[model samples]
Target: MAEFRQAGGKIDITATKAIAYHEVVVIGNIIAVASHSAKIGEKTSAYTEGVYEIKKGNEEITQGAKVYLTTDGAITATAEGNTYAGIAWRNATANDVVADVKINA
Candidate 1:
């Protein structure tokens, strides 16, 4: 299990394997680009999702891309107009980097 403090609150994860409420700290290469609609107030707004980081190979990624990360380590990019309901990246860019994702419990 891993624990961290965020937004003046303590977050804890006790899963033997990575779960939905567990924060994921990933360091990999960008694999692809995705996009979706981001809601502003009560309306849907156009926005680029984010990049998918793979273990290897070069991928074209953009800011505001929408991707579905499977539990088996598979990333599927989607361009449909949908609001992501899980953890979202605050800063979306094309640069290959590490990301710390905090899942809401």
Candidate 2:
């Protein structure tokens, strides 16, 4: 494959803790999904705007259901009048994973 101009790229940051792939991470007010695994003090990639399998909270999420960002960096459906993270790209059970998510929250 040939490399072209940058369409989207991940920002480099020092991981304070272990970050898994496809997990939602927030830097300041910016929300992005982890593109690669990174341990504490390691450099890794994270990007926004692409579909990703993000960690879900205790609430069950249905297809097309809207989700929100929890305090722990997981996506949830119980914002309770707060801002949402994005919409569910696939049906997900509680404590399971939600696939096909795009950042809208």
Candidate 3:
């Protein structure tokens, strides 16, 4: 079988604060991940337009579920008061530190 799908592009932004590598951050639908360590007010590599493998804390998420950015620079299933980051591309267990998401930034 043959199939075709779409992916995302990389974008950079000025960090509001220090961000670790692969940490997910979101301001509304504008989601991104720090490609490397970036200090506050410095330009860091952020993938705002592409799928990213981000860090998820102890929270578990299902496949195809919508992921949100937390206050502590993390991803989770709870979006009650969080910023929408992207969609989970796979199911993530509670023990899994990483979650795959197709970011819609």
lDDT of 3 by residue, 55-103 (tens): 7889789999988877776789998987888899899999999888888
Best by TM-score: 3
- How does candidate 1 score on lDDT? 0.29
lDDT score for residue 23 of model 1: 25
lDDT of each: 0.29, 0.72, 0.79
Q: Give one digit per residue, the lDDT tens place, for model 1 in 11-86.
A: 2222333333122322122111212222223222111223223321123333344443443343323324322222
Better of 2 and 3 by TM-score: 3
Ranking by TM-score: 3, 2, 1
RMSD to true structure for each model, in Å: 15.2, 5.2, 6.5
Q: Return whichever of 2 and 3 wins on lDDT.
A: 3
C-alpha lDDT of residue 70 in model 2: 79
lDDT of each residue in 5-105, candidate 2, tens digit only: 66665666778889987667877655777878899999887886756776666667888977777787677778774356777888877757544567753
The TM-score of candidate 2 is 0.61
